[model samples]
Target: MDIKIIIDDKNIKTLTYDSPVLLSRVIRDSGCGFSFPCSGKGVCGKCRVRVTGCVSEADEREKKLTGENSAFRLACLTKATGDCELFLPDKNITALTDGLCSRYSHSPFGEGVGAAVDIGTTTVALYLYELENEKLLSVHSFANPQGIYGADVISRIEASLGEEKEKLRALISKGLEEGIAELCDKANINKEECKTAVVTGNAAMLSILLGEDVTGLSASPFTLADYFGKTVNINGMRTYIPRAISPFVGSDITCALISGSDIMKNEKLSLLVDIGTNGEMAIKKGDEIICCSCAAGPAFEGTGIRMGAPAREGAINRVWQERGKIKYSVIGDKAADGICGSALIDSLALFLSLKMTDETGLIKNPTVFEGQPAIEIADSGVYITQKDIRSAQLAKAAIRAGIDSLLNSCGAASEDLGRLILAGGFGSFISPENAEIIGLIPPGTAKRTVAVGNAAGMGASAILLSRQALEKSEITAKNAASLELATSDFFMKSYIDNMYFTKKD
Candidate 1:
């Protein structure tokens, strides 16, 4: 049987199979860019694709998720029985690569080209540099293909423990290889000249990349297989993975701190929060640094929520009120297909201000969507349901509790902090005022919040350029104290207290 895969009216690949085969399997085998946000569990209904010719009928689960629309079928549930043409969604995903890097003198170790890669769970950013002169040559970024496994680290860890372990490793390895190739193409340099690469990410991410067993991260104790701070050979390329502070708090935070070192240099107390699937935050007062990780879930990144997506084209990134009506701005000015993290915060804030939702996070007089109460955002068929609100509440509460725990642990409060730095792509575009309104961050700290774009990538680039920055990352990981939030009574209390929409002093 021949299966044709199409993307944007282009015939991307043709796969041959002997018997019935899953469409997702064919796409994955073909190395095509597709997302199975639920890890092909037949849930989420995110992997929608058009199929023509012989295929299995949509099951009850697929029909319920896909609704009355018969034009598309869930890729995970649909199987190509014979010759079929499968169409995938647009592959143009937006990822943030630009970041703020603290200035440091260059003392590079390599002579040829070097690459700095930040392997984020959702996205990957690679920076290519001319090592001799310490000049940046090119940058390349892409949505992490491992997203097919699932959106959160927990999902990835679960996949790593199962039969898909080697598959997970291959996916990330291919992404990095392809990323380096693209970087070299853009820089007009020979690929062999790229002598060194500095890769930084959370501990689980690095473990999966290195093909290390992730069983330690699945249960209590959360033991890390490797606290990487050494060089390893990746596909014959000399690669360095930064040191991780804890099992949950990985090297990404360490690199982000290195890129934004000035935040700690100031005498006033400061907090750095990397808001994503895992809310890893650190508080620095003088020489003392303390950090913790909170499972914020994937709500902030637009996963697990119905009609939620990443900050891609057609995604609503901002929301406001105009003439007593909800108004929103979409990326690329495209039709709003779904809401991302920024718009989620904005919509929640607007809901509270309009009294559409109460302090308990209840939707007032909501309409029904597939039998669930939902609040319609515009007329674009995008709605936030009661369950989605709960997801957002859980995510925001986790982050809020984390901030308070870190502050209290350091014997400080939100007001006492001179600066609260927000790192990563989602952090870069969010409105701090809206964040406070939704109770995602503490009240007074919103005024002091600063979004430092892709600090992890900045730190990776710094390490590639300066040896001193690499040494600093090691020291930061060694000296930092890890706070176990799962075992903290204060975090549990604060988490429940902040679950409500109302602000509590």
Candidate 2:
């Protein structure tokens, strides 16, 4: 039956067969940006859409999953049986980042075209920018295909240890190929026309993408095959990878160091923290910069957590007290779906402020509030379990520990730092107040903390667009002194001690 679904006052007509297709897929095909974390597994519950007119009974699974009134349905699980109107809530519509699509339009230096890539554990984002006017031409992003094997890099590393190594390589390669093709198509240019691509990712991701054995990276004597800058050809696309400082710390940090050049050059001591699955940190003391990395896991990126997701449409990204009431903003203003990285941080911070969560990373009282939906339940307890707190604790601990270790390595204290540069996707979404309350960053660092949105990607783009920038990146990578946090006794102790929401001054 053909049906007309009215979303946000716009009538969308489509033809359907017998059974219902996933409302998420339907909306996505209809040019609606609906985000589905967990890849529409009905686990995220972020694809909620309201149905008008007569509708079928809610399935037991969805009923138990959402707990919303009968009218609301998980778009991933729902099917269309008759003509009906669907309403996409404001919270479900993801707002596009300003200037992201225009950052790479014209080349500053003639005869130069470059691409910046942020090779994340769960998502890969690319920006095509022209060097001339620093105009962004197009932006492309997609779920990291490597996620099919497992959600985290550690899982992928373990899987690579088995016969699935080839599969891992193919997975990363396919995603890069697809992303490159999309960028080229959108920019109306040939692959060859793209003069260079600047790539940034963790050591494990880089190893996997290059088809290098990463067994050493997983265990002791952690050593990378190569850390120095290298240029490789992938399907005729010239790609430059910054010289990795260590096994766990790869070009991503090096790129950040380059993009945060101003901070690094400041005479005053500073700290740069790029929080992610692999937390990378850098501390500048006078003319020297010391760097370190810790395994923070993928808790913040929406893995490990039952209903967590990346910052996408329908994912809750911010939460605050609006006139003494809890209010939140979703990535896409469609509907209340799943919690993204930012939302998880906000939730933890809110819980802390409300005394619902203790300093020991314990949720004192776990209950779904009225009007809010419950997304997951397991033997580990209900939504936002103690286990989730522990997971987030580990993540925060690794990041904080890295910061502490870097400061100690530089023979300086947090107070000595004049500025803090927060880089990467985690940096962009993390609220200063929330970060400070959870102790992810030091107390006074937030005031000096400047969120450099996607510094790795921006740095990569800069390198691609200018030969001077590429040389600077190479120099930055070379100067970086890599500190292996796993081998440090202080780091281990700090990681354990900082695994709480308490202050560690």
lDDT of 1 by residue, 239-310 (tens): 889999999999999999889645667689989999989999999998999999999998988888898999
lDDT of all predictions:
0.89, 0.70
What digit string (tens of lDDT, one per residue) describes model 2 on residues 356-411? Answer: 77788666655553233232222222256566678788899888888888888888
| lDDT computed for candidate 2 | 0.70
Best by TM-score: 1
Off by over 4 Å in 2: 1-112, 131-135, 368-383
- Residue 63 error, candidate 2, Å: 12
Superposed model 1: Cα runs more than 4 Å off: none
TM of each candidate vs. truth = 0.97, 0.76
Candidate 2 RMSD to the correct structure: 7.3
The TM-score between candidate 1 and the true structure equals: 0.97
What is the clash count of model 1?
0
